[model samples]
Target: MGAIGSSADNAAAKSFNAAFKRETLKGQKGWPSEREARLDAFHWLTRYNTRRRHSRLGQRSPIAYKNALPSTTIALTQAA
Candidate 1:
């Protein structure tokens, strides 16, 4: 986390990051443009979040990991 500025980049250090990069760069060498990159990145993120397995998650996909989260809600008040 120290080397990277964003928490999201830090979180990307996990095992799932390997699978994500491999799948994205498998067929195409590189993206054509900003829009193309965005589209491809979105598609990969969706697939990874829904289907990629994780040993730390007891071999469950990230989607499963999220779905298993306890449903709790917290109300927020505006600062007026």
Candidate 2:
């Protein structure tokens, strides 16, 4: 936990931002409009969550790992 308004409170989000910049935004030509940017972000996020293999999840994409888990485990996690 971190104090309100502290950068530490956003450490995880910052890491994700860095990765998104590196993987999606950096070295790319800028979007022509806000709507284009929004659409690109949505596409990238969908690919990241459903297709990208995360090392922390044993090289499984998030959706794959979640789908592989037992129904009871999913239920318990959602209940929490």
Candidate 3:
């Protein structure tokens, strides 16, 4: 994407890691099981993508943003 060791290239990743640490990890030293950790991350990611409000998205979740868009499907054939 950018030149070697570019800050811009890592900006998004850094933001994500910070949020993950703050929200998912919640300062916990460790999980009781590896499966539990994975599941927790999965749940947090799902919630973040579907319910978390993002400023860049006009304070809407990704699912809400998508639902707000107008349909663009072209009609291929008339329905009976």
Candidate 4:
């Protein structure tokens, strides 16, 4: 889980759980079937990685941060 701090992370987890339930779980909190939840989870995971805005990263989403960085740094890295 790409969670943050302790208390805040718990709250965030609950938020995602609810979002997952509504968007993917279809309102069922418990899994009547195992793999269905897994499938839903995988889909949400994709969105979380590619779509969510992360505050710690200065509002840039994960995909945005990854793409914005230089792929290969020079000796400037050491100087910094």
Candidate 5:
């Protein structure tokens, strides 16, 4: 967003990754098994994407915000 290789470009992504790691890890060394790790990540991602309300989205969950939008239909035309 700012420039190539600029921190601002990936600021949002970095913040999200940090939050995911911090909350998922929870000060633990590591998960006991790969299965558990996968499960934990799955659960966290599910809740994060659909259940959590984001301030930037006006305190609505992503799904809720999307549902609030008016539906649009795109018509396709063949190029002559």
Candidate 6:
């Protein structure tokens, strides 16, 4: 684990946050209500997890990678 407030320890999370801010919150006027912002974030997260491709996954979205895994491998992964 990284020390508190250390970016290196939390690089992946920080990268995601930077992308979220850039992609989801960069330009538009602020949401009129907190509920709206929450809804937008939910939708964004859904799409990101299901559809966004990652270089480390050989250009597959996380859902695609998981789906492509063999059942036995998945079972072993879950068992662990």
Candidate with top lDDT is 5
Pick by lDDT: 1 or 5, better one: 5
* Cand. 4 Cα-lDDT: 0.77
* True-vs-predicted CA distance for residue 31, candidate 2, Å: 1.5
Instruction: In angstroms, give how far residue 43 of model 2 lies from its true place.
Output: 0.5
Instruction: Report lDDT (Cα) of residue 70, candidate 3.
Output: 100
Model 5 residue pairs with clashes: none
Worst 10-residue lDDT window, candidate 3: 1-10
Clashing pairs in 6: none
- Per-residue alpha-carbon lDDT of candidate 1 for residues 6-27, written as tens digits (9 for 90 to 100): 6566665764667766777787
* Highest TM-score model number: 3
TM-score of each: 0.51, 0.69, 0.82, 0.52, 0.77, 0.73
For model 2, how does the per-residue alpha-carbon lDDT over 10-45 read when each residue is reduced to its tens digit?
887888988887876769877788998998789889
Residue-by-residue lDDT tens digits, candidate 6, 1-80: 58888767888788898888777776976787999899989988998989999998999999999999887634345564
TM-score (C-alpha, index-matched) for candidate 3: 0.82
How displaced is residue 52 in candidate 2, in Å?
Answer: 1.2
Extract clashing residue pairs from model 2.
none
Backbone clash total, candidate 2: 0
In the range 12-54, model 3's lDDT, one tens digit per residue, is 8788989987987788987899999999999999999899999
Model 6 compared with the native: what TM-score?
0.73
In terms of lDDT, the poorest run of 10 residues in model 1 is 1-10
Judged by lDDT against the true structure, how good is candidate 6? 0.86
Q: What's model 4's lDDT at 75? A: 62
